[model samples]
Target chain A: MEYLIIIISAVFVNNVVLSQFLGICPFLGVSKKVSTAFGMSLALVLVMGLATLVTYLIQNYVLINTWFGEKMDITFMQTIVFILVIAALVQMVEIILKKINPTLYQALGIFLPLITTNCAVLGASILVVTKEFSAKGVESHMMNLGESVVYSMSLAIGFGIAIILFAGMREQLELSNVPKALKGTPIALITAGLLALAFMGFQGIV
Target chain B: MSKFKYLIDGIVKNNPTFVLVLGMCPTLATTTSAVNGMGMGLATMAVLLCSNMVISLLAPVIPNKVRIPCYIVVIAAFVTVVQLVMQAYTPGLYETLGIFIPLIVVNCIVLGRAEAFANKHSVLESALDGLGIGIGFTLALTCIGLVREVLGNLSAFENKFSSSDGMLVFVLAPGAFLVLGYLMVLFNKLKDRKKKA
Candidate 1:
């Protein structure tokens, strides 16, 4: 039940894109078409989940620990380390995906390379380690590794849903006669504002 | 001089926030208030300027295959430095910005400028580009922040516009989107008219 609540809260109450504003780049960039958004979201779901887990381990077991088995808090290195992990992870995923599933890889196209720089992946990983969680009026310092991974997965799902929906809206929007000034990105951003308002309805769910 | 043009271009022509539309994450997330927006922009500028200069200097040495990773590392280092300084000196802004601070490491504008301008240009030119773009980003955020703060909270900077409640939504997440959307439209309209004239 707790895990389910975590997922629900992540996906609805505190959505990664609309509510939190984590990954607005891809949210605005690749969301022109539903098919492209779907592929990008799938890649995000995979990369965010794996990258968070890997970063969590590195944070707990490696960055914070010394070779002498003494625990030293070198947590400041997290920004650099997490980014490096994400960059390397994206590379590995790209190669493996291309070899195993050429069709999916082709669909992903330029987006796969662009994922390396997506703030959502890096933001989710850093947030998992750094964010403090409070349960039942008890202020827990930070999320445990398992909780972190689950949070990343659910956040990615939320991101996927938001982008896919936005893409659908943009597809229809392309046909509508928008004002000249508000044609491309401006109109899309306004649509996002409405979408965010819609997501606000979920605030009461959790 | 052409160097002067780089500076002017960043402010008006290729403005990072309004024109190029890079770094949307921080542009939206941290512009809840005038102060927060300025703080985030300056921090980003510091990182951008240093990384661009460094990347330009090292471009010849770094292998093409490894350039992106190298650029990221350098950019991340500068972000960390900015993060620490902000935490120590501006604790209020630091606490408020929170995760967005570290997220700056992934900000596309920093890396985008590095790859596009810094790698190919001289160190002096890259530094100028970073400064110009950074200022442009700062100006854009401050403008957005001013609008949101005044409309949402009836406050601009530290001063209150009125005693009564404002639209409240202007300070919220949705407000950021709404304000930025209109601003983009307005900017584009002006640019279009200018081009026609």
Candidate 2:
């Protein structure tokens, strides 16, 4: 029941993209078609979930203990270290994707490199740090390791849902002929606003 | 001098958060209240300006192969100063900003500027560029802060000075998204209008 609540809240109430705005770059940049959005979303979930899991362990064990080797604490290196790790991992995935699936690689293109620095990935890392060490609240109290993983995974799923939904809306938008002033980013943003307003309904539901 | 152009570019055309969208983690994370927004923005601005100048000064001597690592070292050193200064004097701002202060070392805006502008430009030009962009970021984040604090929380300027109790959502995570999205819409509209005219 607790894990279910987390999954629900993360997917809806605390949505990674719509609610948190963590991945707006990709949300705006890549959500052109549902199929591509689905791919990117899948990539985000896998990347963010794994990154969070690894970083949590590293922070608890390695980051904290690096102070012992040197009198000067270097935990301040967390951001660079995590970013380098994520970037390297993303690069590895890019290589495999290129060799294994040229068509998929072509589809992903610039977005693949972008995944390294995507805010959602970094935000997930920070969230792990926040969730684990930060003072507990009612919602956070229910979370354990499994719950944490599920929540991050669901949060990424939530990101995909919003992205794919927005892509669907944009697809429909291409057919409509209305506004001259609000054409590209403006229309997309307005659509996002409506989505956000709708998502607001789920607030406090948990 | 031509350096002023470098400065103005950061403040407007290539503003880090509002325009370039670099280093958004801290911008979104800390801009809950006007106070916190200003605090974090200024803190990062200080580090950016200082690091840029340092990197630019060393750019001529530092080998290109190791440029990135050297920049990171310079950035990390300044970040340490920021962390210690915050820990000692402005504990309030320090506590509120939290991990973001340390995270500034990796903020793409700082690193990007170091590699892009600072590496090519003179030390003084780099400093000017950092200051301009930093202030622009400050302006953007503060605007977001104003919107979130007022609308989500239903009170404006609650934390301009040190006051604890106010509309909590302004400082909450959801409110950050709300403010940023609306502001983006508004900003986009303004730019569109300017282009039309």
Candidate 3:
């Protein structure tokens, strides 16, 4: 029940893209085509899940654990370490995918490198270690490793849903008559705002 | 070109938020209020300025194949410093800015300038470009924050001017997108007019 609540809350109520505002770059940049948006979403899910898992282990084991026979708290280096890890991880994943599965590699080729800087990947990983979440009746506490991975994947799904839907709308928007000044990004942003407002109605569901 | 031109260009022609549209995450997330927006902007500026100068200095030695990771390390180091100092001195703003303070490592504006301007330029020119872009970003964020605060909370810089409830939505997530969307339109129109003039 707790895991279910976590998934629901992440996907609907506190959406990563709509509410938290992470990864707006891809949300705006890649949403011009539904096919591309879907591809990006798949890449995000895979990377976000893996990144959170690795970052969580590093936080618990490497940062807070004993070092050189003396207890040391160097978690403040979390940002630097996690980014370097994520950067290296992305490269490794790309190389492995190229070797093992060229079909999937070709699909996600252009997006893998781009994911390095996609704040969503970094943001979700950071939130996993730092933030706490609570659904309506559940006790609020820091998520365990399993819960963190689940939450990260769900957040990525929420981002996927939002971007996919926005891309569909943008496809229609391309055919419509927008004001000359509000042609491209302006109109797209306003549409996103409306989508965000619509997502607000889901607040109390969890 | 003059040294000052680099700075001014960042503010006007290549405004990070308004014109270049880089670093959308912090621009949308942190601008719920004027003060929060300004704080985020200044923090980002400090990192951008430092990383730009360092990256420029190290550009010659960094091999082309590994430049991106090298730049990321330089950026991540400065971000760590900023994060630690903010946690020590201004805990309040630190809490409000939350993960974003650290997320500065991924902010495209910093890395963008490092690659686009710093890699090819001298340290001083890169620093000025960083400052220019930072100020432009700061001005844009503060403007968005100011508008949202006034409309959403009937306040500016945390001072509530009106007792009556404001739009409320403007202080929320959707308002950030809405405000930025319209602001982009306004900026576009103004730029067009300026071109004609």
Runs of candidate 2 exceeding 4 Å displacement: A65-75, A96-110, A132-145, A174-183, B17-29, B57-84, B98-108, B151-156, B159-197
User: Which scores higher on lDDT, 1 or 2?
Assistant: 1
Any idea what lDDT model 1 has? 0.90
Query: What are the per-model C-alpha RMSD values against the true structure?
Result: 1.6, 4.5, 0.9
TM-score of 1: 0.96
Q: Fnat of candidate 2, please?
A: 0.09
In what order do the candidates fall by lDDT, top score first?
A: 3, 1, 2
| Runs with alpha carbons beyond 4 Å of true place in candidate 1 | A135-141
Compute the interface RMSD for candidate 1: 0.7
* DockQ, all models: 0.89, 0.25, 0.93
TM-score, candidate number 2: 0.79
Scanning candidate 1 chain A in windows of ten residues, the lowest lDDT window is: A132-141
Model 3: per-residue Cα lDDT over B107-136, one tens digit each: 999999999999999989999999999999
Q: Write the per-residue lDDT of candidate 3 for residues A1-206, one digit (tens) a residue.
A: 99999999989898999999999999999999999999999999999999999999999999999989999888988988999999999999999999999999999988999999999999999998988877789988999999999999999999999999999999999999999999989999999999999999999998
lDDT of each: 0.90, 0.75, 0.95
Give the range where candidate 2 chain A is weakest over 10 consecutive residues by summed lDDT.
Answer: A133-142
DockQ rank order: 3, 1, 2
lDDT of 2 by residue, B1-197 (tens): 77688878888899776567677667767787777888888888999999999998899999988777678778878887888888899998888777677667667788888988898988888889989988998888888777777665555667343344555654665456556656666776788789989
Provide i-RMS per model in Å.
0.7, 4.0, 0.6
Per-residue lDDT, model 3, residue A169, is 100
